[model samples]
Target: MARGCLLAGARLVDPAAGRDGAFDVRIAGDRVAEVAPSLDPAGAGVVDCRGLVLAPGFVDLHTHLREPGREDEETVESGSRAAALGGYTAVCAMANSEPVADSGAVVEQVWTLGRAAGLVDVFPVGAITVGLAGRALAELGEMAGSAARVGFFSDDGRCLQDSGLMRRALEYARVFDAIVANHAEDSALAEGWQMNEGEVSSVLGLAGLPAEAEEVIVARDLALARLTGARLHVPHVSTAGTVELIRVAKRRGVRVTAEATPHHLTLTEEAARGYDPVFKVAPPLRAREDVEALRAGLADGTIDCVATDHAPHAPEEKDREWDAAPCGMLGLETALAVLLTELVPGHLALARLVEAMSAAPARARALADHGGPVAAGRPANLVVFDPEALWTVDAAGLASRSRNTPFGGRELRGKVVHTIHDGRFTVRDGRVADGKG
Candidate 1:
C-alpha cells in the first residue's frame, strides 16, 4: 500500500488551478509523476475510480487533537486517523494543550507525535500568549525556528483583547509571514452567555451572548491588522455582522481571512431550543437570517474557507446538562457531507466546494504541499470519492476516540472512497488502510 497508485477515470477537480476533466493520475514514490488519459499501470496498484471525483487532500486550519493531557478525549493517533478517514492530508494542531505549545520543545513534541501517527501531517501551532492567559507573549521566535517550523499561532479558546498585546503579536508574526488566528469573542460582553442572544435564549431562560460580543472583536482585530499590516485569520465566524465586517475589511484592503464551520452553515438557534448540548458551540449558532448571510458570504468569496473546528470531548464531559457541557462538536468526519447536503445544487457548486474545503484553507494557513492541481512534480496528497454516494453517520463507527459527532444517525450524501497520502493509500475502499508507516 505504500507503493505508487493509479487513479483511473475519475473527474479531477483542482480548484487551485481551475482544472476539471476526466484523467488518470499516476503517483510514483512520494510525488505525482504523471497525469493523463489511459496511462499504463506500470506495476502500480490500480484503483477503478470512474464516477468518482479526485481532488487535492483537504487542509484543516482549525483542529483540536487534545494530546499531551486529555488522551481520554483525543490523541494525535486517534485524531489523525479520523482526519485521514475524512480525506485530510494535513491539519494544524492548536496549541491549547495542558502545557501549551509555547516553546520549541513542546511544539516539536506535537510534530513528532504526528510523524509517528503516520496518518496526517500535523503542524503544531504556537501559542500567541503564554499559557493562553492573554497576559504576556509566548516564544514566537523560538517556535518559528523550531523543528516544527510553526507558522500559525493562536489563543483559540481565548482572545487577545488587549489592543496593545494584539498589536505586538501581529507585528511580531508579520516578520515571518505567520498568521495570528483569533477566536473572536469579547470575553466581557459574552460573560455568562449560554446561547445566541435573541428570542431563543429568552424563551429557553438562558443568558444570551449578543451578536455584538463577536462582531465588536472582529471589527477591532481588522483595524489592528490594518495598522500592523499583518495577516489575520478569524475562526468560526457565526454572525451576519461579522461577515459584513470581513467583507468590508477585505474591500478596504485590510489583510484578513475568515472560516465558517460546517455546523454554522447548517444549524440555527432553533437547534438549541431543545437544550441539546451538542448544538452548543463557541460563538453559538445564529438565527436563519444570519445563516443566510453566512451562506452568501461563502458563495461570494467573502468567507475564505470551511474549517472543521473538530473539537472532541469525553462522553462524561459532553453528556452533561446544557449549561454545564462544553461548547463544541465533532466536525472532521461530517463537514464535507454536511456541506454537500446543505449547499450544493442550490447555493454552491462542486468547484467552489473544493476551493473552500481545500484550496482556500491551504492558502490561508500557508501549507505549500497541500491544495494543488493534479499534475506532475506536485506532492501526491490527494483524495478520491464517490460524489454521488449516499450514507448515514453512526457515532460509534467514527475513527476518533470520542463519539461527540452532532450529525450522528443523520443520512448523508457523498462518500469518500479512497484517500491517497504521500503517494500511498491511507484509506482504500472506504476504509482506513494500514496505519503503520
Candidate 2:
C-alpha cells in the first residue's frame, strides 16, 4: 500500500519540463512517486484536482519579512503563512531587518525562524554593506559560509551609491559565486521624492522621483558588473530606460539579470492620483509608457522574473499624510491574483506567467528543490490554482500582520486551491492547512 497523497486529474503545467497536460500525480513522502494519465489511489489519500492547474510552486526572488526588529509589521511565521496561501513555496527574505541582516549571526537567526515556521523555505539575503550604510563591505564570506548558506546579498532599502565600494562588493561576491542584487537608485537624484515624476506628481504637488534616478544607478552598476565579471541582479526595475539598459546588457553578454514588481507591471503613476500611501513605493510607480516597457521586457525574457518587493508597514506608519507616509505595500497575498486578472491572456501568456513567477526566480537564486518539473523523482513543491476562480481582496482577511494592500476591495481571478511543500499540505482548500495535514 502506498502511504502518501494522490492528486488526480490536474492540468499539470510545468514550464521547466515543457509539460502541459492532464495527469495524475502521486507523492510518497517528500518526493513525487509518479505522474501518469490516470492512477489508482491504492492506499494513499486522494485529492480530487479535476479542472485545476498544477504547476511548480512560485519562488519570490525578493521579499521583506521585516523580522528581528519590525515584528509588529511582519514576522517570519506570518509571512510564511501568507506566502503559502499565495502559492509560493520559497521566498528570499531581504536584508533589511531591525538590526539588518549584515552579519552571519543575523541571517542565521532569520533562517532558523523560517525553519520553525515550517510553512515555506525562507532563504535570507545577506546585506552588501555593514549596517547597509554602503561605506564598507559586510562579511559576505562569513555569511555565505554560515549555516544559512546565503547565496544572495543586497542592500535593498538603500542603493550602494559609492562606486568604488560597489565594485569591491561585486568582486567579493563573485569569489563565492553569489548574487549582488542592487536597489538601483541614485539617492541624491531621488532625495525627498514622494512619487513618480510626471503629470500626476505635478498635479498633486508632490516631489517626484525621476525615472533618470533609477537609470543612472543602473547604468553605473552595469558598467561595474561588466568590469568585475560578477553576477548582478537589478531589483524592482521601474522605467523604460532601465529595461532597455538591461536588454542591451544581456545582448552584450554582461552577467546581469533583472526583475519587475507586480505593481510596476500592472499599475502606473495614475494610481497615485488619489494620494493614497498604499500606492506609494520605493522607486515609485512610473508612467504608462514605462509600465508598457516593463511588460514587454518580461514578455521578451529581458526581465528574468517577477519579484514582490513585499514591504509591509503598520497602519499608523502607512496611513500618514502623503509626504509623511512610508513607501511599500503588502504583496505576497495578492501577487498571483493580480497578475492573473491583469496581465494573463493579454500582456503575458499563462505559461510565461507561471515561468516568471516560479522557474525563473528559482533558477536566478539557484533554489534546486523549488520550481519543479513535477516529475517522479522531484521534490513535491507545487501549487494548484483555479485559473477562473474570482475573489475580492480584503485587507483584514490577509495573513500578514500589516494591512496595506494596494488591491484592497478589488476583485481578482486565479485563486490558490492547494499548496504542497515537501509533500505535505501547507495550504488546502484556499486556507492554511492544519497541523501539517
Candidate 1 local Cα displacement, residue 67, angstroms: 0.6
The TM-scores of all predictions, comma-separated, are: 0.98, 0.98
Where model 2 places Cα greater than 4 Å from the true spot, the runs are 1-3, 435-437
Q: Which stretches of candidate 1 lie over 4 Å from their true place?
A: 435-437
How well does candidate 1 match the true structure in TM-score terms? Answer: 0.98
Question: Judged by lDDT, which candidate is best?
Answer: 2
| Model 2 steric clash pairs | none
Question: Model 2: how far is 310 from its true place, Å?
Answer: 0.7
lDDT of each: 0.90, 0.93
lDDT of 2 by residue, 1-437 (tens): 23379999999889888988999999998889999989999988999999899999999988999999999999999999999999999999999998999999999999999999988999999999999998989999999999999999999999999999989999999999899988988988888899999888889999999999999999999999999999999999999999999999999999998899999999999998888889989979899999999999999999999999998899998998889999898899999999999999999998899999999898888899999888998999999999999999999999999999999999999999999888888999998985543
- How big is the positional error of residue 428 in model 1, measured in Å on the Cα after superposition? 0.9
